[model samples]
Target: MQPMALWKRVLILLVCLWGIAAAMPNLFYAKVEAHNDAVAAIEAAGGTATAEQEAARAEWPDFLPSALVNLGLDLRGGAHLLAEVQVEDVYKSRLDALWPEVRDAMRDLRDQVGAVRRAPSPDGILRVTISNPDGMTAALEAVRALGSSVVTLTGVGQSTLEVTAEGNDIVVQLSEAEKQATDDRTIQQSLEIIRRRVDEVGTREPTIQRQGEDRVLIQVPGIGSASELKALIGTTAKLTFNAVVSRTNDAGADPGPRNLILPSMNEDGVYYIVEATPVVSGEELVDAQPAFDQNNRPAVNFRFDTTGARKFGDYTAANIGAPFAIVLDNEVISAPVIQSHIPGGSGIITGSFSVEESTQLAVLLRAGALPAEMRFLEERTIGPELGADSIDAGRIAALVAMGAVGLFMIASYGLYGTFAVIALMVNMALIFGIMSAIGGTLTLPGIGGIVLTIGMAVDANVLVFERIREELRSQKNPFRAVEIGYERAMSAIVDANVTTMISAATLFILGAGPVRGFAVTLGIGVVTSVFTALLVTRAIIEIWFRISRPKSIVV
Candidate 1:
C-alpha cells in the first residue's frame, strides 16, 4: 500500500503527542492541584505567596500543562445533599413589598376610610383594615391599579396582584398565575445561588440543579461533609438595612404592627425592634470582599449598585442621628446611629469575627442570598478513604479489562493485533487528554465507560483484519487485501460510531450528574477509538510493510 501524505502523517503524530501531554497531569493529580492552587492564591494576593505556597508551586513547573479532569462526587467521596426550599417565603416577601404601595393607594381615600393598619394574616395573604367599610370600593380600585402584568408564558395577560374586600378589611394576594411564576423564579434563583456558593470556594465541578418543584440536589466533590456543605451554602445571608424603632431586652416583646423584634447577633441580652420593610436588601449589593476594619479587626466590605446606593443615601440623609439596624437572617448585627449621610454605596460590616469567618461571610455575600431558606431532606458524606478505595477498584477494573482485551487481540489476530493494541492505548490517552482539556468530571459510571471503551476500541481493527482475511481467501495480493479491507470496512465503522455518538449525545442532553459524566467519556472515546483504528494502527502497519516487504502474509 502507498504511504500516507507527509502532512497527514505528521498531523496524526502531533495529535497523539498532544493527547499524551494533556493527560499527563492526572498521573500526579495531588501535586499538580496544589501547584495550581498556590499559583492562583499568589495571583489573587497581588503576586505575594506564603512560604508553604511557594513550596507547593515548586511541585509543578509553570510551563507544563496542568489541566486535569475533575473527579465526581462518588469517585472523590464528598458531600451529597437533597434540600427542599421553603418557597412560601417568597410569597410573604412579595406581600411585604406590596404593603407600602397598597397603603399609599388606600391613603387617597383616607377621608372615607379613616385609617389604614396592616393586620397579621396568613403567609401569602395581605390584610389591611380600614376604619370605614364604605371606602371598600375605592380601596379595591386603588390596589387594582397597582397590579402589573405577569411576564411569564402561561400568565401572559394576567395581573400580578389580586385585590378583594371582605367586611372592613381589604385583602390582597398574588394572582394564581403570578404565584406560579414566582415559584419557578425562586427555585431557579436558589439553584443558581447555591451553584455560585459552591463554585466560589474553588471546589471542583459540583452538581447542583433543581429536582422536583421545591427540591434541589447538591453534590460537591472534595468537600469535608454534608453538614459542612449545608453550612457553606444553606445560610440565606439575608442582609438588610432597616429603620430601628426601639431597643428591648424582652425576647417576646411586641414591636407594634409594622415592626419586628429581632435579637442581636453578638450581644446575648440585647434585641432591636426594626421596621418590617428594609431600606436596602442584599440583592442590591454588587460586590463584597474580606477586609480589615480601622481597628485591624476582620470585617466584610460591601459595595452596592446604583439603585441601592440611592436608596441608602436617601435613607441615611433623612434619618441622621436615628439608629438603623443591619440585620442578617433576621438577627440584628448592629444598630449604629446614622452619624451623617453615608454615600457612594460602600460600607464596612464589623463584628466579632475570626479571619476565616470574615472570608466565608464575604463569599456568601458575593454569592447573594437564597430567595428562600433550605431544609436538608437528605445528607451524606463520603469519606476520603472510601473514595480512595473506589479509585483503586476502578483502576484495577480498567487494567484487568485492558490486559484481557490485549491478550485476546494478540491471540486472535497475531502480529496485526499488536498494532491494534498500540492504537487502543493511544485512543485511551486521547480520551483522557480531551476530557482534561475540556475540564470534564469523572464519575463512578465514567470509569465503567472507560473500561467499556477499552474493550470496544479494537473492534474496528478486528473488522478490518477479518475483511483482509476474506480478501486473501479470494486470491488477492497482501497489499491489495490490506487496502481493500480498509475501504470496505469504512462504511461499517462510520455507521457504528455514528449510532453510538447519537446515543451518547441523547444521554448528555437528557441525563444529569453521573449519567452525564458517563456519556461524556463514552462520546469522547468513540471518536478517539475510530481515529486510532483507522489511522494510527493502519499507519503503523504501512510503515512496517515498507521496511520489510513480504510476498505472502498470514492473517
Candidate 2:
C-alpha cells in the first residue's frame, strides 16, 4: 500500500535476480565453445532429449534458475586436475646466479696454479697444476669457497708441482637436494596463489588444494575441460637474460679491466659462454598478450616498466656486436643479435612457437613467476562423467530435504504453512544472492548446507506462526496478533541464528578448500534465512492483511 513497502518488495526481487545472474557462468557453460557443443548435441539427438529423459530431469533439480544461473558440477559434468610444481629447476636457477662468483674463483685458482681444467665430477672439481709447492698451497686457499679438496699431489719438492683438488662434493649434492625440497614447498605456496587468481578471474566453485607433498588438486564445477586449467598451473616460466659468448677475432683477449660487472666471467674453466646480458628482467613486465607479428607468426607482445626499458636500451647500446639471449625456464628460446637499440620498453619475442605455445607463455608471464622454479611431479585428469553423477546425487539429496521440510511445514501448521513456504523461497533466493555476491563455490557439502538452511528458515517461520496462533487464540485482533507474533518470536530467532552464525564463522576461519566453501555458504544461509523469515515473510503477511480485511486471520 505504501511506496516504501513497494520498494522493499522490488529490492528483494532484484537482489535475488542479481545473485542468480552472478552465479550463472559457474553453474552453466556460457562460453561460445560450450554453446556450440550443446547445439551440436541437441541436433544429433534428433532435436530434443527423450520425453522419458526430460521427465526424469524435471524430477531431479532443474539447474536453470532465471534462465542464467545453472547448477554447479555436482549437478553438471566437469573436469578435475591434479598436478605438482617442479622444484629441481629452482636449484639450477640458484646455480646460475652463482655463475659470476664461480667463474671468478676458477680463474684465480688457474692463475695461481699451473693451469686448472674443469673436470666432469659430481663435486664440481677443478684440476689444477701448480708451478711450485707454495703456489699449489696458494691455489687451494683461493678455491676454498668452491668447497674443493686437494686430491693428489706429485713432486712435492721438485720444480714441477701438480695437485688435484676436490671440494665438498657432498655439500653440493646436498644443496641440489635441498633445492628440490624448496621447489616442493613452492607448490604449497602456489596453492593459495592459484586459488586467488582463479577466484578473482570468476572461475566459480574451483577447488584448488594441496594434495600430499608437492601436488595440487583442482576441481572446477561446470568447467567441463581441463585444458585451460592445465595451461594455467603447469608452467615453469623462469625468465633470465645472459650475455652471448664472445666470438670476436680476439677471443682470448682478456676482457678489459673494469669494476666487476655481472656479464664478466673468469676466462679460465668457465665452460658456458656468456650468451647475453639481460637488461630487462621478466619481473618488470606487468602484462602480456598473445599476438602475431607482421610476418603473421605467433608472438607475445610484452610491456616493461620504466626501469626495465632504460636498462634494456643501455644493454642493447653497449652490446651492439653481441647477441642477447632470451632464456625461458633456463631453455634458450632466441639469440637475437643487438643490431640496434630497443628502448621502447615493449617488444615482441619472435620464435617458432605455435599459437597455443605463445598463449601459454603469455599467461605464465602475466601470472608472474613462481618464487622458485618448479617441476611437474604428477598430473591427472578427472572425467566429466564422475562430476555428472555427483551432481545427480546432490540434486536428489537437496530435493528430498526440501520435500521433507515443505511437507512438515504444511501438515504441522494450518494456514501459517503457506507463509512459511514463501519465507523459505526468499531464504533460497537470498542464499544464491549472497553466494553470487561473494562468488562462493557451491560444493556438495555446500548444497547440503543450503538444504539444511531451508528447513532452518521454515523453523523460524513456524515459531512466528505458532506465536501468531497463540495471540489469535487469546482473542487478540488480527493486526494485533500479527504484531505480537513477530515481536515475541524475534528474540528467539535471533538467538538461534546468531549462535549458528558464530559456528559457521569459526568453521570458515579454521578450514581450507571445501570446508571453507561449506562454511561460507552456511554462514550466508544463516544470515539470509533470518532476514527472509523475519523481514520479508512478515512483510508478505502484512500485505495479505491489507488485501483482505477479514474479522479473523487465517492463523
Q: What is the C-alpha RMSD of each candidate to the true structure, in Å?
A: 2.1, 11.1
Model 2 residue runs over 4 Å out of place are 1-81, 86-88, 99-185, 192-205, 211-213, 221-232, 246-281, 306-311, 370-378
Per-model TM-score versus the true fold: 0.94, 0.70
Give candidate 1's error at residue 268 in angstroms.
3.8
Question: lDDT scores for all predictions?
Answer: 0.92, 0.63
Pairs that collide, model 1: none
Question: What is candidate 2's lDDT per residue for 125-157, written digit by digit as tens?
Answer: 223333434455565455445433322242122
- Candidate 1: lDDT of 64? 94
Question: Tens-digit lDDT track for model 1 on 1-555?
Answer: 667899989999999999999999999999999999899999989999999999999999999999998988887889999999998999999898989988888777899888999887999999999998987888888889999999898999999998888888988999999989999999999999999998999997899888988999999999999889999999999999999999989998889877899999999999999999999999999999999999999999999999999999999999899998999999987888999999999999988889999999999999999999999999999998888888899999999999999999999999998999999989988999999999899998999999988977899999999999999999999999999999999899999999999999999999999999999999999999899989999899888899889898887
lDDT for model 2 comes to 0.63
Best by TM-score: 1
lDDT of 1 at 219: 93
